[model samples]
Target: MKNSTLGPPDSEAHELQRNLSNRHIQLIAIGGAIGTGLFMGSGKTISLAGPSIIFVYMIIGFMLFFVMRAMGELLLSNLKYKSFIDFSADLLGPWAGFFTGWTYWFCWIVTGIADVIAISAYSQFWFPDIPQWLPALSCVGLLLSLNLLTVKMFGELEFWFAMIKIVAICALVCTGLYMVVAAYQSPAGDVASLANLWNDGGMFPHGAMGFFAGFQIAIFAFAGIELVGTTAAETKNPERNLPRAINSIPLRIIVFYVFALIAIMAVTPWRDVVANKSPFVELFVLAGLPAAAGIINFVVLTSAASSANSGVFSTSRMLYGLAVDGDAPGKFKALSSRAVPSNGLIFSCVCLSAGALVIYLVPNMLDAFTLITTVSAILFMCVWSMILLSYLAYRKQREHLHRASKYRMPGGIFMSWACLVFFVAMLALLALEEDTRKALVFVPVWFVILGLAYRSMRQKKSEGVQLSYDAD
Candidate 1:
């Protein structure tokens, strides 16, 4: 509503509108970063690192904090830069933009499917007799409809989506504190203690293997952390709001992750949780609540739906930016009557529709989920690596720009090198994990494909320039 724009130049003169406020940006970052993965897949994280999983998340959080700072500083450099890829290009090169933009787009598409699939699975909690395909289809139709209304509507929806997560997490932390430090013993078991986190099998219960193992899975939970940066163009006060989102989002994620994982492990012990099931849900059951499964089931289902909602919003926004930049199909560049990039929103929803087919068509559910996560992580790694590389290039090639920056990165290239190394190490860690190895395979293949695509686009541009010169 507040940030709508007029029609695409190619379309009937129109406007594009989006009603995202600074409040919305903060919550979107909160909601997007704290995904269903932490709620559902955290069980696996607990199983891997045991209690040490908490430490793993903190470590990754620190690395990504620096990543966000780099992104924020880059975004602040130019108010007109709508797309992160634009900044990537300005900072690094056209190749960086080409790779980062497309890869980031690809990552969300994969992540969106996972969210949709998870949404359908969550729906099964309340409707055991209903077919999975129906709910998945219904969800796709529903979110698509909501996004089409207006940009403000999208922001409003995200606000609620984020509110749900924030509320649930706060409640969980309060309840867990009552149970742990308050020493309130539930009917089902012994009282909890902070000691449970360290004393049960010790802090490093799973040993170095488990400690390393947690990194492979934990990184994926942090996938949407950059959503705040993506919204710089849309925000009314990028200088103020974007920095606020970047500063607070990481700390919130770390708290949510470390506390929630600690609570789950304290109640059930890492060994007691089902490898395939959600540990968040199990914490309620362990607390001896009669409605544990249903309550948590509802919460996680909402979590998945919330994730889908965000994936659609961000992907469409990215497409809208690329379209405006001549990086994507021009039609997708068109604005809505409401000033939102309605065309790109529709395009992303069409892709999301494929989730319905997957509801019933997969060969195996876990296998399909694993493939999706692997690809998402690989693509995300590529996008993140580009950001770091772009920052590195920016510092060296644009010394004047760096000195001119009001929000220059501290230690400058020093932090840039650390972040890049961290990104590469994450890719390597993905390769080492049996659970995440396919990600390694998919990522390089993606780079090669992007390379070819970039080359083709360059050649076309060269021809276009030559033809224009001849005409002149």
Candidate 2:
């Protein structure tokens, strides 16, 4: 890890515009918390964990709540800090900032690739003949164009995207409740009742290993939940809105994740759910609303778009931050008059265009999605772990700031350690499956590459300095 003596960016010169209002921040946070994972991947999770998948979601959401709280406190502690990456670089070291900033950028890049692949898969529902890479490539181009307009446009895009997701979940929960109350029976002969949760092999049909299988996909589902922390720079009122957004995680998790899973399982037995299809669509079908299934498909298609949109915004911002710290090319540090990172946005989109190549080569879409998402989850874990580690450092070095800060992390340092332990357990679970283990083996290679890049960049900076001395 190379330590940087460079000071923070000039506060007024490089500051991102605060264009995201309260409604945008709220919806962005909601959009971040709920993603394609719930809309598309829940079927696989339900099949693997049986009805116990509900507990899987709850536990994951619970652990991440503390992570957000730590992030909230850190972002609120200093107005100069743009995001977690900003504060981590300041407290932990320059190396921590360089690694975390770039690692987070790569995390979203991997996630964006997964989202585009998902978009292609979902588009096949409407147009089967279109090549998977076509929709994938088109999505990147479209989002890149929208992102370049202004920061507020990005907020509006997420706003409507999140609205579609929230409406779809609400519709499912309402329809499921109606079916259970009316004693509706599905074509598969399962009764719509609360008993479906435990009666089907007592919620742990596949036993301990089955329960563990849920972690690999479930972790990916929660990958974008930390998007709130990234918007601290663009938020109109960080002191009020940031805390409000972070504290609402429990409610959103319960409503969007926990309740949605329970409702779907109750309407359609866990055994009847197919791992390869969207459970949301299957639930509407089970309820005899076949026409509504198409609408559900459309909602999920946009859900993938939403997640990918977020990936573009996050990756560009991370690159901008990295550039400001001298870790990346200074061209990326130049923001447009609109205060959007135009160069950074284009660079990320160009890299994201490779999602098309991955889709073209992989042959099997499911295998491609699995490999990409698993690798993304691993990289995100590294970013999350860095946030927790930064929190520990903040406690040790900035105790006075912690005491004086209005938004302090609850459970203090103990919860931070516990979250770290929980992440290790999730990694162990990911290692259990062959496909996921392959991704696990490949994750460290990214860090090694990053290390080499950092060393080379450091050497170049040193050479430049020595030449200046010789000339003098």
Candidate 3:
């Protein structure tokens, strides 16, 4: 918001000042890019692709990097880009904006539920006797309160949350590297080598099917990559800091996923990397490190909590935005004294509390988590499609942008089309797969709900206009 504005601008023009510092923006980007999916699901991926899983992550990372670059370009072009939804609506038309904004809200809301399940389930690993619902409820309560603070406070919280995750992963990579070197001449008599990668019945031990199955698990690892774009509204230096963060996507994938996975595989063969356990903590134990399980558990707990915090933050902001646009109850847009979207935050958190109830009813959390994750992934796809549509629209209407499109997605229009095709294929694949098929059913239901909500909002708007005209 400009200093000249007497108070906040009109709700539609309600700008999020670039108050987030460089460090906060960088860490927030990382925090969003990494999630519980990496630590909890990595072992499952290892089982699917053996050591070849690293290659799967690399491929996904390359594609996602291009996507982020495209988003960064559009956001950079317009200082008024409140969020991706604003850009989407302004460029891709009203339908695109409505779908994108609501779908993103669903993405985080579902993801938050999944994180709650993980948090409760992980807590059981430490305290097996405790009721799962108890921890889930408690965590939901804690993070809900934390997120009801100012946006700057939220940014600072994410900063530390991302820092912890970064430190944990880097330490794991470094420790794994050391273990591999040490294992070469150790008494176990297994010379630590890249050969270990193939020792478990070769790289494609499970064959072509296994490689394809890699996507099943690998997709979860890339769950939050789009999260970087969500923070554009809050970044301190959107032009400078965002480019710095977006450019690092490729490097992070290489360093954290590819090289780190290689280091772990070199030390321990795929056969020994137990599919049911965490590959991260398992590496520490393999290296003969003490208390590795506890350490990893702490990191995962904080990771889950951090994500929940963000879920509350993003969903609230989106809802508040919608409310201002007359798409939701006017009450939701009201700010607390701290300038926090307190009402919206509470609303989303209360919805997230449903996880605790579900856990109480169902013995297994995995089924619920999987279904929600699929829908969340689909929602994220919708958000991405909106982004591409926005970019495409912006290119046609705005002539100046054409002269300076250096960072255009590779293959230009072709890659955009390719990505859309890939997303459609992904949806089809979800139906083909047992775990993700539920979203095929659920996503359509979500659109129906959104359609009804839009109609109701339109009715309300028309009535308001009529009342004003009568008074005039």
Candidate 4:
């Protein structure tokens, strides 16, 4: 396979290596599918939407699956393209690449900050006396050291992290199923049964508005679903592995998200779930298993670390790509002996430390988390929308390529438009909540900054070209 075009021109020494194997790719995709948002944020989602939160996850997963398929087709169409940023630039314009690349980088950075805050909060579960920022900064330091070692190291870390999450979810589902069969009764005198889903107040107990409110946080839970697209440059056999990973998204969502959520609501009933606490932990505690609650807390702690690790890996690679494309500083183009972008990694970690500052400022963890995640969700939607837009552009300009391709996006241009509309609807949903609406107002400032930066970049390039012309 050709080296990724995002790599430095004319230098094999600087190219990102294709070292991630099939297992790594599969696990990474799985890790991305299950994010910290599900473990930590689902309680709020349940409280807001009642049992209808299940439908929220399903709808988001369904729409995002199409986004992944579109991305997979585009990345596979040109072997040299590394990530969505590359193709967006090619199929759309330089502005699209700049905006997508930086926005995506910013998306992860914002997400990493959220993860840091989550780690701090989870650490408090085990060590209540420890200062919050202590664990947050320590988590960032550990991930940076491990990531600096090799790309495979990152894969191995994610692989194990995902395994923990999978095992926890599986155990939760099994436990819930057992409870349902035995007609297990919780301490609150509520019986665990499938009927619990609607027996109390019906599925849409919160009505349409509550159902709509669920979208705000549920959308955040799926933030990293497109992450596999970022690993395109490093994945082995992109033609084989990429398609396998993308195709399995539906099943993963059903098993991990839908089934796991069903288990939570069935065990405790939606009405009794704590809005500010983890439903996974609460489910275990409701079943009178305090030990399992503690273990689930540890599981969530690792889940937060997993997400931060992913954010670190992706952000660095994105900066490297932007640098190679002349949209970022030249130093970020440098790679370590391991072919990892050390400069980008360090820079991202530094940005991640800002999470500690946020914690100090907001004081209220839930409010801070809600605001940060909403911002992340909004930026991630922008990146996802760009992928759809790029797909639409590809179908229009490269009809021959589409016809010749083996893995064409299902529903093609039509689904692309549909997904775009869904994202717009999600933005409207974000406006319904006070915290999320505050986030919506903050997001425009970021775009305005990017707009000004892009214009400055263009003017400099034009001036340089003019200088060369005058000398000639």
| TM-score per model over all chains | 0.92, 0.97, 0.92, 0.98
Query: Over the stretch 1-472, how does candidate 4's per-residue lDDT look in tens digits?
Result: 1123644544555688999999999999999999999998999999999999999999999999999999999999998898988999989988999999999999999999999999998899789998889999999999999999999999999999999999999988888888889899876688999998999789999899999999988888898989899999999999999999999999999999999999998888898889998989877776678697689989999999999999999999999888878898879989999999999999999999999999999989999999999999999999999999999999999999999999999999889999999999999989988889999998999999999999999899889889999999
Candidate 4 deviant stretches above 4 angstroms: 1-8
What lDDT tens digits, residue by residue, belong to model 2 across residues 239-277? Answer: 999999889999999999999999998888899889998
Order of candidate numbers by TM-score, starting with the best: 4, 2, 1, 3
Go through the candidates in order and give each one's C-alpha lDDT: 0.75, 0.89, 0.75, 0.92
Against the true structure, candidate 2 reaches a TM-score of: 0.97
Model 4 poorest ten-residue lDDT run: 1-10
Show model 1 residue runs off by greater than 4 Å. 1-18, 182-190, 359-363
Count backbone overlaps in model 1.
Answer: 17
Clash pairs of candidate 4? none
The lDDT, on a scale of 0 to 1, for candidate 4 is: 0.92
- Tell me the spans in candidate 2 whose CA falls farther than 4 Å from its real position: 1-14
Q: After superposition, how far is residue 450 of candidate 4 from its true place, in Å?
A: 0.3
Q: On a 0 to 1 TM-score scale, where does candidate 1 land against the true structure? A: 0.92
Query: Which candidate wins on lDDT?
Result: 4
Ranking by lDDT: 4, 2, 3, 1
lDDT of 3 by residue, 11-118 (tens): 444445556788887887788778777777777778777877877788777767767877888877776666776677667655556677788888888888888888
RMSD after CA superposition, every candidate: 3.4, 1.9, 3.2, 1.8
Q: List, residue by residue over 1-472, the lDDT tens digit for candidate 1.
A: 0011222344465534335788888888888678767876787778878888888889888887787888888778767666577777666666666677778877887888888778777787889798777877687778888888777777788888778877777777767777776675645565677777777679898788788877765777888888877776667777888888888855796568887777766666566667679876666666667897887788887787887887788888888766655667778767766677778778888888787776567846566676677778667767777777777776777778778887766666787788778877777777777758865776778778888988898798789889999999
